[model samples]
Target chain A: MKKIASIIALAVVFGATSASAQTLKTVKDRGILNCGSNGSLAGFGLPDAQGKWAGLDVDFCRAMAAAVFGDDKKVKYVPLSAKDRFTALQSGEVDVLARNTTWTSSRDTQLGLNFAGVNYYDGQGFMVRTALKVKSALELGDASVCVQQGTTTELNLADYFRANKMKLKTVTFATSNEAIKAYDTGRCDAFTTDASGLYAERLRLANAADHIVLPEIISKEPLGPAVRHGDDQWFDVAKWTLNAMINAEELGITSANVAEMAKSDNPDIKRLLGSEGSYGEQLGLSKDWALNIIKLVGNYGESFERNVGAGSPLKIERGLNNLWTKGGLQYAPPVR
Target chain B: MSIDLRAGSPPARVPFYNYPKVRSIAYQVALCAVIAFLVWGAASNAIDNLQKANIASGFGFWDNTAGFDISQSLIPYTNQSTYGRAFWVGLLNTLLVAGIGIVFATIIGFVVGIARLSKNWLVNRAASGYVETIRNIPLLLQLLFWYNAVLKALPDLRDSVKIPGGAFLNNRGLFMPEPIAQTGFGFVLIAIAAGIVGSIGYYIWAKRRQDKTGQQAPVFLVSLGLIVGVPLAVFFAAGLPLTFSYPEAGRFNIRGGIEVVPEFAALLFGLSIYTAAFIAEVVRAGIRAVSHGQTEAAYSLGLRPQPTLRLIVVPQAMRVIIPPLTSQYLNLTKNSTLAVAIGYPDLVQIFTGTVLNQTGQAVEVVAITMAVYLTISLTTSLFMNIYNSRIALVER
Candidate 1:
């Protein structure tokens, strides 16, 4: 009788304990971060020939892993589709969403998601076949436009057409790839999506010169990292990790220069490198936290150049994503 | 104490309740308790999580301004409209697609189903081939094929394939002549209404006269003439007022015409073709359910094959066909949710997806979507149940 009672008691205790523990506690106890990403988008998040995930968004994931575990390799990348990203985060299926998700008011408020920081500034634009002799969106009035459903681009297309008083017809697809296919086969007169997406899509075509993306940016899309809301501690850690990357870049610290700069005489550099103060300890991290991130994923500039900037095939211009010192909008708060 | 009890207790009686039955009831009560506890636990957990997130849990968001635009609204809608109004638009679109699909699918399904059972070798094989091919493939794949492979291959607007009577087909969409109503349109409508009422009255009178006398009334001829003649007379009396406003090919597009967007066309075509295969099978089963004896009996009574089928077989077959047919209609309505997959901006696509994303009320948006779908399913089921009961067999 005593043995049976003890067994029931143990079962009750175990069940109650497991149920009460939060995802944050589990993540900390496990000593690794589970990061969600886009497995196919080239310049945003993609796996290379060596099976190593590399891209601007992938770097943010790596940086967060480094900040948390002091080892960047502790990240397990879970590939997510557009429809599954939010649900994955909400269900604790992933620790962080470093996919190139747009930071929008509805997503932030209604989806119970927290935007970490803006990493890429993007905008919706239209792409048409150059042979059509269409120079601008205005020229394509009454044209059949192919757009992906369940995205901000759909709403933006409607707004643009309504504002311009153009009686355009639209065709919708579940994915951008399908929409591009339809457009390529001459089903739609135009395809509309993010300008960065257009660049990525055009590269996959048989002839790159056949299509041209229009210059009119119909909507603002600030792509960023995201986490589930209601956990302020986790939100701060993710947000500051991105900010540290940008600050490191502005301070002229590359992955190669990170170790040397740790011995710098500058007070701000000393403080950032944990040489002058113990700021890292305040965030429940080691003294070389920022240094570890820079070594593993490099600074923001290095990541951008390697992924979607002038050095890559995407060749996106750093119009608004550049540092404030370079007359762009990317300015981060000082670490001190 | 025992010695005194022996005098009073002469015989022992068994308790009223049996142990086995009591045990069974106890086990059932425990099972019910476990299930209830599980459900209650889940509900409480969800409430706790939602409270922690500070998210409001209700249907209040439906009354807020949608602040979004739908591309193809049958009714007038702007960004300023409430979310509830947007839902109505989506619901209307869903009904429109399902209603049109049912009519077309029924006609095609009945013909094809009969053709499959035909004695003619080529016709039977052809109908069988269509049913087997379409029924095997997934609906989503079929939709993509129609939207991408077939429709996308059309020529550009400048080189649009022009049809007779001022119609144009291009990669964009199909543009055709639209009817422009003149001043006399009201009279034309009234005349059509009058013709409908007159035909109904004539049919009843003809049926009664046939039953009373041994003479046949040409009900078909007289009704057709009344319905057609009245409308034609009104058109002439109203000075032949309807005008065809043919679409003109402008520099960019065909102007002054009714445009049917390619998305809607592709969705409709794909849905109808896919659903018709299932409907055909239902029709074949329903028709086959009618006994062979019924056909033989009709033939022995001097009725021809056509009249035997029209008067005897169809009525009985309808009893078997309707219940399953109602389910198919519900399937079509639910399947319209897949319109979001292709960007048709149906209810699920426009309201639950786009508006939900723009508004950020996950719980509310999902709830409203569930309610809308539930209402549609319930209403359809209710109507069909009433129909089924009316056609049900009555036994003495």
Candidate 2:
């Protein structure tokens, strides 16, 4: 009888403990971070021919690995679709979600997730073929549009059309590739997605020069990384990793100059680089957590330039992602 | 005789455990208990896990505003409608596809099945070739072929090919004039319904007269006259209270008419063609299952080949066809869930995909989806079973 009671107790404990434990400890014990990522979207989280991932979101996961294990390569990228990303994070299938997911209020409160901070400030926009001769989105009245399903863009498109009092016909696909393909085939007058995605996907179109992204930024889409709720330590670590990147960029700490700057006498730089404070310790990480992130993944601006900015094929201008000191919104609180 | 039978029974009394009735009941009770325990455990475990994960549970999210647009909706729906309404729209779309797919498949299947047995070499080989080729390839690939290769290969919107009656065909879809019923249309609709009832009554009376007297009545012509001719006459007499709204080509789109989107058309065509191949095989086997003796018997009765096959062979073949035919119908309905692959916004795409994503209620959404498919399948089986029973052979 006692043995049976003990077995029942063990079962109860095992059942109660799943997905509610400290994520950092679990990740450390597992020796790698499982990062949910977008495997298709270029300049974000796509994998190349050699199976090596290189993008802004990919660098975010690398930064997390650097902060936790002092090695940026200790990450396994779990590619997820827009529909499955949050569930993957919530179910502990991925330790962190660095996909290009929007940080909406409902997602923050409703899903069991915490958006660390905005890494890319984007907005919904439309892409149309040049032959349409349509300059503004308002001219798309009574036109059919192709959009990706399970995305905030779908809702935004509907709302935008209804607000404009236009008759909208939408064709939503499961993936952005399908949506873009359908649009290219003249199945729709326009394809709507994030502005950044539009630029990246335009490169994949057959007649890349024929399509143009519309000038209307209809919805605020602050894309960022997220961690599961209930683990504040894990949340803080993810949040600070992004903040450190932004702060590094603000402090003029590029990856090439990060080692030189670590020896600087500036108070903020000293605290951030783990020379003057125990901030990393408080977040249950090594003293050189932020230092490793800077050394391995580079600062936020460097990552942006290499992945999606003028240095890359996407050639997206840093309009909203520029640093606060440069009159943009990519600001981080002082490390000290 | 009773004493001898009792003496032939076991010399010793059988134990309660050895009794067949007691053993069967005991085993059944144990199995039921085990099943109940497993179900309870799973349910509780799911509830506990959901609570631990901090994800809200239940069907409360069904009432929430969906805030999404469906490309095609049979009912009046907007983004402002609730998720429950979106679910109905998706279900209706699925039903529409399944219902049309079944009808087309049945017609094509019966024709092809009969043709496969034709004496003409080309027709038999062609029918066989269609069945073999279609049923072998995967359904998803067929759907993609239809959507991408066939339909998308049509002309662009600006270069739309014009069809008769103010219709246009483009890669986007087929655009046709929508019929708008004006004020006195109700009377015309009522007249048609009355005509249908009159035809059914006339068919029954004609069948009875043929049984009573040896003279056969022209039931087909009269029924057609009652159902179609009466409606047409009434429509003309009522001064044609229906007008068509023709589509106008605009700068960006062809606007102001009913449109059949290519995604829906492609899904319908793919499902019908693919399912028809299997249905044809089932039909062929069913017809072959009726022995040559039946055909010989019909031929010996002074009946012609067409009448023999239609009256004698088909009725018997139906008994064999129905059980498998029910399964095919169920398969077609369930396979319509693949609408998500091509973005047709069926129940799986709308409720399970979009709503589940928006609400982040995976457990609730998935459970509801499963329950819905279960109900649909069971309901289909129920109706098919009833029809089967009505036509089933009664034995002594």
Which candidate leads the pack in lDDT? 2
Which docking category, incorrect, acceptable, medium or high, applies to candidate 2? acceptable
Across residues B298-385, which tens digit of lDDT does each residue of candidate 2 receive? 8998999999988989989999999999999999998888887788889888877788789887767766777788898999999999
Q: Among all windows of ten consecutive residues in candidate 2 chain B, which has the lowest summed lDDT?
A: B1-10
User: Candidate 1, TM-score vs. the true structure?
Assistant: 0.88
Model 2 clash pairs are none
Candidate 1 chain B: minimum summed lDDT over ten consecutive residues — where?
B355-364
List where candidate 2 sits over 4 angstroms from the true fold. Answer: A1-17, B1-19
Residue pairs in candidate 1 whose N, alpha carbon or C atoms collide under 3 angstroms:
A110-B360, A172-B342, A187-B152
True interface contacts retained by model 1: 0.29
- Compare the candidates by TM-score and give the number of the best one: 2
Compute the lDDT for candidate 1: 0.78
Give all TM-scores, in the order shown: 0.88, 0.95
Off by over 4 Å in 1: A1-24, A48-52, A78-84, A104-107, A137-144, A155-170, A265-267, B1-44
Error of 2 at B132 (Å): 0.6
DockQ of each: 0.26, 0.38
